[model samples]
Target: MGLGLFRMFNCFSSKPREIPIILGSETPPRPKQRQRKEELGGGGESKIGGILGRPYVDINTMYEMKKELGRGQSGVTYLCIERSTGREYACKTIARGKLVRKEEIEDVRREIMILQHLSGQPNIVEFRGAYEDRQNVHVVMELCSGGELFDRIIDKGTYSEREAARLMRQIVTVVHVCHFMGVIHRDLKPENFLLASKGSLAPLKATDFGVSVFIEQESQSHMNPIHRRRRQTEANKACQHTVQQNQRRPRRKALTDINELYRLERELGRGQFGVTYLCTEKATGRQYACKSIARRKVTRKNEMDDVKREIMILQHLTGQPNIVEFKGAYEDRQHVHLVMELCRGGELFDRIIARGSYSEREAASICRQIVNVVHVCHFMGVMHRDLKPENFLLVSRDHNAPLKATDFGLSVFIEEDKVYKEIVGSAYYVAPEVLKRNYGKEIDVWSAGVILYILLSGVPPFWGETEKQIFDAILEGKLDLESAPWPSISAAAKDLIRKMLAYEPKKRITASAALEHPWMKEGGEASDKPIDNAVLSRMKQFRAMNKMKKLALKVIAQNLSEEEIKGLKQMFNNMDTDRSGTITFEELKSGLSRLGSKLSETEIRQLMDAADVDKNGTIDYYEFITATMHRHKLEKEENLYKAFQYFDKDSSGYITRDELRHALTEYQMGDEATIDEVIDDVDTDKDGKINYEEFVAMMRKGTLDNEGVIGKERTR
Candidate 1:
């Protein structure tokens, strides 16, 4: 019976490994080549056969080089094509210099290995192959015809919440995959992300893994010792001097320790502990804000340990949207620098100071984001003990873009059962337990509560004249909800703040639990609206049709006679197949197909949805025309949105005058015109109101008649 069972198992396994049997001759016959006359069927011997085993090309053969695409610290990148295959590739060749250290060389090789392992992933740069010469090592990679995402953000000013969120999701997914494979991309920033050529809003790839590291699970412990010793030595030297002292000292001859001062640019900001500067990555000219902390001043061993721990924590907390990305940490003799994504909008503190104060709803929106970020951090076993308005940075004006929580200098990692007794965080936001030197992750929750309170009330819940008084007020835990200034504060919000600011750390609500509170979950009731997916999809399709319409309009504008151009508007009006003031998907798709350039249904939908601000079922003539023109303009080059946004100057859902005047002074019909003329000429409505559609129509007509009115094209 046992023999039979074993035989059954073997039979089941054998079926899985089955291969097709080949039944053929025992020995395969080899074909013999004929003489040149027979081979060429021309009665002449060929030399090709004689050269079969010889080298076909010289090793140092030079090909025609094109424009230099970009450059980096160690190498230069060029747009090149293979002579034999005519395939385009990005050739990155390292320069011979001491700056290209042995470790960095190893890093490049490791990057190659990582790229090779992740070659087929959709959001990673595909590595072709590598070549080494006497002086330089050349790495050939996929040429991303689409430009960098950093450029797009700069040109457009900033991304909308939805766009930023979507992009973050893609980035996090890539990071997730990398971490799962034990490969850490030590350098991850906006400059390293590249868009695909096929779609404007397609997923971006995480590139430039030159500083990446891969460690086995078991060997990770062994590697920490070497890193720690290096950190100690660097810390010792940094402590022995100040920035001025270090600057005056003799520079190291070693390229790695030379401190590439040429790369540094203007100082962005400085704090008590560190300074940040806006610097260009030498190779790509991509700008980055490098935040440098002087290790000399951070003399305490525990504090140094905290900094190192923060780096490790950031590496593990890759997918959280609200946290500012931590690109690798670098330690030199003078400073220990932590490079982060440069949020150009600056801090929430600046915005608050500029605006005076945010509305209750706006504050609530920010509070929700704060809660989400803190919750994500706590869930990952890390606590951001310092939660203040200064630490929250606005990435964009769109209320939805995740507010980046920065400054993890005081962060701590704790297990579920572990309790921390270190007193940390700002005095104003510190928890009552923290004053007693008995704190845990709940201290972070309390600090977050303080931020939420300030956001809503524009003041701290507990205020006093001094630090002692503040601690006393915190201990009392009396929530003054009935005060004159707190009239507008909702009961739910007050309840949340009270729970989060509980005197006992154990009684305080956890970040995750606080996120589910009624105040946050149900706060969107005021802005709630049903989403019509079908209508939205149709509108998106209409936007896709804009490309064809735009080209047609441009051709008519440039080539047609005045009389013909004048008649073109009527023709365009008639071309609106749906008669809903806009062209429909079917009409546009059918029309384009006749020109032998048909857009797929998916493409049409994506374009339409991307352009449609309103979830309306149809697009009007002006909307259709503008969308088409914008699509075509973006197709050819960058900064499409910079010009496109001007068309919507009124900040209304559509474009109108008034809207055009807000965008362009030339379109200002004249302040002397009566309201009636404004209604008649610019407003489609007979009710004397000039809507966006009417304004856009008038502006389009005016622009058609004028030339060189708009300023020179600015490349952002």
Candidate 2:
């Protein structure tokens, strides 16, 4: 069987003695394999190894545990088959000896609660069921025969660029969903990510919420000051132990702490928050970094506040697509710990350092995702006061998901109309306003713009030997856009960066607005320009529709006199065909025909084209009235010109069509039919020509109807 087929079997066999070795399966030979797997397990075996030996879990009876699958710090995960359903499952069991403290039990329970709440999330690992027996708490999850992402990375070395982008996109989407719902996965790393298959398209799942917390909304009750202090006390101890352990341990070997049994792997890295270990989940034989905070580090008041605030911020920012997720937070006597989603692809900063720099397109793609994340935070009234390259970590090479934004140490909460006074963040990317201690979330935008500038140019816009010089350079707000390296940057990108790094906070473009910027447009294209004609037409249509609707309502409300009502009804009747009280397009066309203005067979199309803003064909009463008024305006203008022409009897200036026709009929020059035909023919250029030139000529004394007198006189 494949490695995936053997994953569940490893969970049920935790003890070093009890581990079932499969001859034909892909199990590694004892010593050589242990060295390779031990790094992921960190330095403790107590958490993973003892889980299988728990007396409460009847692994033999409940599940026919097969080959060992993987391990972790706290439990062993096995590939087991349910006899009744014959369904496959990955079962995790906590060993007895490893359960040294009450907090460990609480951590397990907390994970169960979190998983229950997150049951509907498809991207999250599916929780099957949990059982409590005499010896252990047995938690079962879906068997993703795909195995750990860490191993895949190892097998493949490094992923292709497309693969990395695809993975980042998927992971970011998952993180976004979690943030929307107010859940934060504080610990995000590679081993926490499990692949559902070995294929490139395999689904990635974020698991291990051993230290996650759900902050109740609208309540400060859960904010335990003393509890946090105590947690910090524990974290300090954990930090001291970790530092001491590191000093004594040799390179490439596992170290063990007396407090915990899990073998610690080499240190991945250290941060102000805590140290991360590449340890294995011994029970399941899975590798994961168990990030532990030493009790010595978090003892300060400010440090504890940072911890709590980070949790709060993560909880509030539940749906952001790019932020890293917090799996869970817990505490041992020596440490306050957080379990997280592990990204095997490593830090973005590291990648950039190794590769030197990314191309403009690659940089833009990364920046766009970051902008999206910042947008989410700003919309929710939160600020990630510290946004730097170090905080951006890649999940995979497919770029399926965005690089996860980690390290919320310096973040803050800002309510509406509130401004923050904290002077925090790395000196390199810090905005000028932040240095002056007058900054808000827009500072983050400025930092982001600076980062984008760096990504594209391989250097930041403002740099100095010291913090002060950097601040001065930022305040100067000068960019050498015309300089050698800078000149190559696209105008759109330069424009975006300038807007983002605007010196004045008020003038700085907001995150949502920045997303609409030309640089961020899909495929790096510019946004669509405005259509002037559409705008003007839409405005006129809106005003006319509103006015007509008001008038129609007033007429129906019995507020008008009967005479006025009759006049309004007449107007309505003129447009309403079939007398159905509603004006249909057919009725309107017929009415126009009576006035010598006939509509085309495509009249419906014309009406729709003129009246429908959203392009739905059917015109309501309001739309009908508005269209009619517009057409009426045109006709009224024509009539006024014709009347003026008729008054000018000489026809040198103007004459109405009526006067010319009358003159022709009276003189017997032409009868009604002939006069009508002549007038119609004379009205050239259409519009019932009654212009001054035509009117004066027609009215000149030349002919009379009775053959007796010829005069320019008005006849009744």
Give candidate 1 regions above 4 Å deviation: 1-262, 397-401, 522-716
Stretches of candidate 2 off by over 4 Å are 1-264, 281-288, 353-358, 397-401, 526-716
Can you write out model 2's per-residue Cα lDDT over 1-716, one digit (the tens) per residue? Answer: 11111121221111111111111101111111121111100111111212211112234544677766777776687888865357788888766557776455444544655564454354678765554444666677777777777787678887888988877776886676455444555566777788876686788887776655443344333324325333422212221212233233211101123123234577666543367776653323445455677666555344444554564455434324676655444445576554455667665644543343345566667788788778756544457877876578787655444688866656654432444544456555778876565666688898799778766555567755333456577778787567645555567878888898888888988887888776786676532332223222222221122222222222222222344233445655666766665654456556555645433323222333333222222344544443333222322334334434334466565445566556443423333433433444334555664564443333231211111000000010
Worst ten in a row by lDDT for model 2: 707-716
Provide TM-scores for the models: 0.41, 0.40
Error of 1 at 337 (Å): 1.8
- Model 1 has an lDDT value of 0.50
Q: lDDT of each model, Cα atoms only?
A: 0.50, 0.50
Model 1 / residue 384 / CA error / Å? 1.1
Error of 1 at 405 (Å): 0.6
Return the top candidate by lDDT.
Answer: 2
